[model samples]
Target: MISRRAASPKRSTPRLPHLAGSAFRSRSASPLALNVMTIITRFLSLAVLTLHCVAFAAGCTADETSTTTTLSTSSSADASESTKESRVLRHAVFFSFKESSSPEEIDAVAKAFEQLPSKIDSIVDFDWGVNNSPEGLDDGFTHCFLLSFADEAGRAEYLPHPAHKEFGDTLRPHMEDVFVIDYWGDANEVTDAKSDDETELKHAVFFKFKDDASEEDVAKVEQAFAELPNKIDSITDFEWGTNNSPEKHDDGFTHCFMVTFADEAGRETYLPHPDHEAFVELLKPVLDKARVLDFTTK
Candidate 1:
């Protein structure tokens, strides 16, 4: 759980924030206290991963784009241009990290990144993560994440902010490899916001499991997600599934699950829940290469 509000300064030896919030704020780490090194690390992670997703999707064959155009009829490239104009994907950075990263290391990395992740103005939804796995594949990157905003300008504002750049400077040396991609969230895509009593805090967690898992594995995972909504008092919504990305975009990810809450406060409530605890126990056996990204988005 990361949020902002602090002085601008670097520590001779940086320490990441340990949190405890109001559901959203871990009771431990409240609003914020600057940890320059952590911010730099998250920024670097964000940019490198962002580029990775774009690079991966950029592989979609132009021929596929052409083939999708009605084979029934098409005279020139002009008609294709028109279709391309009608659909554009808003891009976000997704990073996959080494599987062996310790919880302390991951938490340390997440903590240093204490910047405000907002869904303000213009167009899309924004998010970021730690990878979960049942082992085997690791091309060095495994922590998949999502980034969204109102529109391109909103993202542009985020790209070169002092906070972002500082992160890039710090993370380059320690990183092994990274990937990023971009996509759009259509304004037409309708999602019903939960009612008022639920508005004070809102959060979503998205994760996908390995594609080759058995049916039983998936069922176990769903049970885990389902039990989360019940085990925690604050959860208002919970859903799970396999991803429906255009086979072209899904790479290594397959099964997906998401849970939403009024805010971080309610979200934190689940962290220590017993069902969530038991589910965690059940999960280790059936899950594979799982990825988790938690964020505040509407």
Candidate 2:
């Protein structure tokens, strides 16, 4: 695979996460509107590591079949440069409840979050998630979602997506408390994240290697690192890859990875798994240079 530079980080908000009702008990919306936003603020408090993905973008440019199956597994950041900035920013939606809800209820909300894709607005990207921790995060909430749009107008249209509002109404009875936090994020801050909190889950991470690393050699390192997720069950979502081009760098930096867990414990479980230990061993050899960044959404 030919290497291309990584794409620039477009300033965007984080997506709200969606957890499965089956995953945990649902919390009722708290009496305080600010309570929901506060939790998200706590999440934004974590850094979101951006992996340079111009190479991943190049990889994505291949034929249709490869794009979905092969490229999905590509190692490193998958950011694409987005220009024509407008009122819309990347939207990160993070919410948690008090307990687990039924699968049907979970599906209802999942569908609500899903409506943004074709909500008749300027939206161009959307993704959602369910909390996957095995237990311990006794909180009633169970999901988080991240949605991206071309501009703020797209976001405005989304608020009343009739469908989304319906989702809130549908979730009202099953929910104990709903939390939300919205942040205006920049690519530079995301890629160069730092943090002091050891309890929250890490968002984005950055790494840079010398210019001499050939595309094939880079591919080998990724192949070895990709298997890290296989080690355990606590990992809710895992995405890791490298920056394709040096030219795309906001700085000379070039690679990064991101992992999301149900809570801090899920992340902690994955850290010591035997397979993860091996992954560290494999990565250390190819890692001529590296840096680890961790952050939350707050």
Which parts of model 1 are misplaced by more than 4 Å?
1-212, 247-251
Residue 177 in model 1: shift from native, Å? 8.8
Best by TM-score: 1
Candidate 2 lDDT at 45 equals 58
lDDT (10s digit) by residue, model 2, range 196-289:
3423454443344546767777676666555665657776555553433212322334554556565666767876778877766755644555
Clashes of each: 49, 79
TM-score for predicted model 2 compared with the true structure: 0.34
Q: lDDT score, residue 126, model 2? A: 48
Error of model 1, residue 222, in angstroms: 1.2
TM-score of each: 0.36, 0.34
